[model samples]
Target: MNLPVMRVLLAEDDPHDAELTLERLAIAGLDVEGVIVNNEADFIKALDSGTFDLVLSDFHMPGFPGSEALRIARSHPSALPFIFVSGVLGEEHAVDMLKEGATDYVLKQRLDRLPIVVQRALDEARERRSRHDAERRLRESETYFGQLIDALRDYSVATLSLDGTIESWNRASEWLFGYPAEEVIGRPGDMFNLPPEPGQPTERPLVERLAEISTGTSLAEERWLMRKNGATFYASVVTTAIFGNGGAVRGFSRIVRDMTDTRVAADLLQMAKEQAEAANRAKDRFLAVLSHELRTPLGPIYAAAQALDLRQDLPPECRRSIELIKRNVEVEARLIDDLLDISKIVNDKLSLRLEPTDLVAILNGIAEIFREEAAARHIELRYTPLPYPVIVQADPARLQQIIWNLLKNAIKFTPRAGEIGITMYQPMPGKIAVDVSDTGIGIPPQALKRIFDAFDQGEEESAQARGGLGLGLAIASSLAQRHGGTLSVRSEGQGKGTTFTLTLDDPAGGDVQAPAPVETPASPSTHRPATILLVEDNGDTAEAMQFLLAEYGYEVDIAENVAAACACIDAKRYDVLVSDMGLPDGDGIDVLRHYAPAADQIAVALTGYGMESDVRRCLGAGFAIHLTKPLDIDHLIDVLQRDNRS
Candidate 1:
């Protein structure tokens, strides 16, 4: 084995004794590097000049004693080992040297034992240093842990003993549990839990919890906990086991957070959601009832106008008056449709029937519908058809509705003698663009941003004069996006004319500048004259429809209610059944059930309840077709004239 090197400071007056002491130490397995100092000044200089692990000296020097050397060595910051070697020494002097902090004393006659004494002193000094460092680290760890516990103000932190006794509590624990550390320390950890309700089982015992946590796992719970004042609150508690250096369970740490407010907030939000759903249901019912009441009267009025328009002996002024009444009725019907469409969009219930349709055709048809009205207001309505068809995947009716709203808005806002232009072209390959520009009261710069927002009509005075619910642009914009397209507007300033641009993706297969297709009118039906049953509740609607059906070469019978319709069905056999959905006693579905037509007979439902769900319900109840009011006279005539020969 190799012996460790030791630096020794030798304080001796005789050089021979110093040499002999180092020789004895080296023989006894000590590696000694010695510096001999004969005087006190040399000894003190040697000690100050370098580092040494041990100090050796003679008992009596010429001018200095070993007692003085021991005193100087003990004054250093470290616990350096000091030993005495002397040739002549008394017991009294030895006692004095030992009391002065010498590690050991050996005489020259017993110099063989010097190495053992020196080795013992060095071992004891090293052990002292190890213990000192360990104690310092423990102090720092405790201080840091205390600061961390105090800094956590939101959670209640408590330490428990192996048996579940509260050992320490932080400041947050006092605030949350309403107890001071002095009162809670040494108490059972379960004291924070609320007592079991009457006749209920008690909580788990401390021994049970300790056994589970001894396996080095954590436990979590949420329940009511009682404070010091006996007031109870909900909280979430988590208990984790803390371990020692030897991997044994030392104790546990418990954390608690209040959860009463969070629970109450969740409940309140659920209640609010339920209330909103109820309000939405009520609004849908109100709109359905309102639609029926408003549209019921318009059916007969429109039928009467159609009947007069078919007259060949009316004066030109009378004919014009009839036309005005018919136009206003159609406008009213469109307003109702707008209200229902917005509701459907809001509820995410709006659906489309998409097909490859001609965009140019839709634009031309809508522009022609408004041309006469625009001219009456002294506005020039301009539209130049493309030679070829611009085709896109779209719902034909909904696509027409979008363009109709845009052109109608232009006519309403444009001043007399102002020009309203409908321009169509392809801005790029695979893209079709339509620009509806009007020299009208342009939108303000600030209002332009939110012009498409529902019910946000720019320039309130103009909107008031030209009355509308202001849902047109919002519905149009939403529909444009749904069709994989965009509707955008740009205007320089007020009165500078606004241009609305509608752009859509165009699929292949339509020629550029292709001529519009000519529509062929349906020829009069060549089938045998059919018998009809008309079920209507309103007197005017029942009578007008009866007269129109008779004029169209059909045997028509009228029934005012469910009982009358059943009576008419029992008395006579009819080939066609035309019934309004809303009757006095029951709905039209009841009449169809009573009629029980054969395979060749047809059942047609006419009503003002035009919601998508209503339409589905009518068709599902076995109606051949469902139509909404104010009735389309030509479509009804066409339905009555069809060949039901199957």
Candidate 2:
């Protein structure tokens, strides 16, 4: 041991023994600072104010003893070492003092060893203090690391040893995996009971994978993990090797995030995008088909009317036949408009005007309208009365459209002498159900799955013979869904009758008085001749309309441009004006606004854009009727006939 300076306090009543001890310590090569206290008061004062590295006390004193000095030093914050020096003390007494926390005990006669004993005790005390500081630092570091892990909420943090044993689990891990730290701490990672593939023996054989990780490898992958209740969810896992002081691999730390909901949301969004694209394609196809269907009939009606107008000596019967052609063309145009409306409904672009609608009255009106169609088909159409007055919250026009389409479909499909039955009844207290059944070729079992889909048609021979565009039921179903109701079909395959049921929830209220009906105007026979101006850019279409209208008793004036139509409007007061929506100079709306026709003078809009917004804008612009071309001759005749008398 190296020689060092030592501060020593000596408490003894014998002056001889204390002198001998100091001399022996000096001879041992220690630089000694020594204080001798022979009484209790002096020893207490010295211990209170003085500092010493070691305390050497005699076993007995006049007023203080070695045992008393040891007690005093033990109670101090800075615990000074006490070495007992005694000549007469028994072995049992020395053993008791040592056990009571004395640093060491030496016989007074053996003063030569005092310096060596003092040096050893001081070195040991310094070592104990260093060890205490190191332990405190280690505990603080552990606490800080634990808090860091607990603060994370998004992902569960955990660690596994080289054997795939769970060594640590954080608070987030406990919450996410539904396991307490105590339960999972020493368990294997695969004890969570994950899903096993067909022939796989274990859910996640992480032990084999961890061996590679412990050898300084890294892994990043996605796997499904099981919860406490055995429900599996996807997780993104990242693991890497932890290193020791010498850069050797230690263990691994893993971070996992649950991706089950995220994956599901992504899939759903992709599906919706695909559906929107498909709907757009269908809309494009419908518009193309509608354009072809409307333009086909305009050719014949225009030619017949033009021929009749140029003939000044035409017979009365020949003149009437030309008028008939004009009337039928208008009817066909109306049918096309109806079909376009159904397309809007199918695409969920149709808006409704909500009002209190009387279902019975609407059904009755539909029966009257389709009575002629049914008669012509030689099919008997019947509507049975409901047990109670059924009033519903619905759009009146839309409801009429729904009932009309269903009725028309029934009449079209039913063969001659077939029976068609329509019944309205309250299936529940606050709900109304309408059933339309036809004794015709019924739907097949295989085709029933897609019957409500737009453009879907049945394979029944009769339905194929009496062909349709297959949009009626699709429109009906969409309307029903909009009304918080449903439309369903039931049949016993082909050759049997079919029933379509429409169930609608009734509005909140009891029965109320029904509204008065508006009667359709009587069909006119006497055609009044009036001045008319027609503006169209297409030569063939314009020539046809002028001839057809002139032959039907109208003084028809035709213009191929906006400037010519404006000239005619300024020169003469016409009873009615007909214009194509798209013109060479401007649109029809521009022509109508420029002329600023009187309120009494009727204006009709004819265009190929048959969207609901298109029709609404035309009507909002003060047009009396919105018609899309190819123009229906009969519908045009009705409108013209109505305007002629007005």
Candidate 3:
């Protein structure tokens, strides 16, 4: 319970009057502290010397009047409260004192009213100081904001009135347009625009921009603008509408930045991009021709190996050597396929034939294929599928390829007697997760960040020993994303083992009932012999395939080119026609058109071009089957036998 203290400056010729004033202020529960001065010199010195809440002066002092004291106190910078307390102050002189700057007057006979007058004057002084401080702060803030706008040397900032006349211009604006503030303050905002050519409207007039900003708030655009010297340069301009406190549109603010050099650089980059695309197209064409040329020689080699393998009297070592040759030829063909697949992916040419397929069944089958390879390295490869079918809309062949790549890497990196497991489970509702984990030397912390990047093999010595082009994970990751799934990897550190997870959407979302498994039927034990006409441009490939078909109990005729095949076709009708896509005279499509086989007769195409477009072309040309070279002999024989029975 502390009371407020009021300090007083008292001007009195007699000490008794000042004492009486202090006693009256104290009676009102105000803790009064007073400084007394008797003369004019002492009163003025007291006012300047220290802080006081209010001033009390006697009306008639020796050579000093309360009116003079009131005048001096009012003119002081502090705005201190002033009151007259005197017995000689008549009503007329008291009224004059308050009008001259006295806060209020109290007759000495009415000393009881002095406390009320002093208290009200103290409260009023406090309010005046608060208002003065607020106004000073506002003025300082506005000055600082103006200085900040002038400091931005690279941009021109201007303000426009509601009618689109310039109202304010910053220093940068003066430097940019070569006009002083006085000259541009009342000018139209469009004074900096480049003149329009005859019959051509001006580019995005100020009024049109303002109309858009009235609805949308802001607009940014690029156009050429004229400088003071009539030279034109590109500029990026941003204009925003200014709103008043009551939400009415008041004015607009515009910012301009020169962009002539940036515009030139952008045009150069666009030209470079076009040139790079053209170079990529040429590279694709070159690779197509190269693949055809490379696969042509492998056809003869592979077919001759199959022909040798068919001989039963051959030595065991000679048979094993032929098997090795066949296996390596297939491996080489796969390497070529990888190169072409990467090209297709980069150009967004890869496509999927999607269907609702059994995901668990596909994983189990892939695991079986890799079991023998894993056993050869003394690795325990394990994959256990769910009891029920996990169905998803996906391309089965592409899905198999993705899993094969992940498992292949796991086996390659795992040492002898290491463990590798494939697990599938629901990570959450509506999502399916497949994890391929291996007890191999794990990825280093630094390498894990970029493990799926193209051509980024880890810096591990073991990884270097297992050679590859480092495209498998990159291609698999990209394919996973294309199928609306994701591929991710986690490893603790080097030597702690690694796990690669592939996540996909579960189409049915929850547990589903199992469907009865469908069993595949066995192929026919023997083939029905047929007369076949073969067209091929490569002489070695033609001889090897003809000899192999003869061994398979088929009557085979060889034609070196499309014209020879046509000549043979015109002479006799054949049960089957085998032709190559690329020939010296023309392609196999021309031969098929010339042969014009009946609906009962079958046409088969063989070629080195295995692109999706090439396969579609051969099938659309009435070929019953299209086989890519270097050809798989067993598959071709099975195709002929199956179709022959039908």
Candidate with top TM-score is: 1
- Ten residues in sequence with the least summed lDDT for candidate 2: 508-517
TM-score of each: 0.77, 0.53, 0.61
For candidate 3, what is the lDDT?
A: 0.86
Off by over 4 Å in 3: 14-29, 58-60, 84-117, 174-180, 193-204, 211-216, 220-238, 256-277, 296-335, 341-607, 611-626, 642-646
lDDT for each of the candidates? 0.86, 0.78, 0.86
Ranking by TM-score: 1, 3, 2
Better model by lDDT: candidate 1 vs candidate 2 = 1
Using alpha carbons, what is the TM-score of model 2?
Answer: 0.53
Q: List the residue pairs that clash in candidate 1.
A: 387-513, 387-514, 388-513, 388-514
Tens digits of per-residue lDDT for model 3, 305-409: 999999989999999899889978987787677677788888898888888878888998999978888997899998877888889888898888788889988
lDDT of 2 at 129: 75
- The candidate, 1 or 3, that scores higher on TM-score is 1
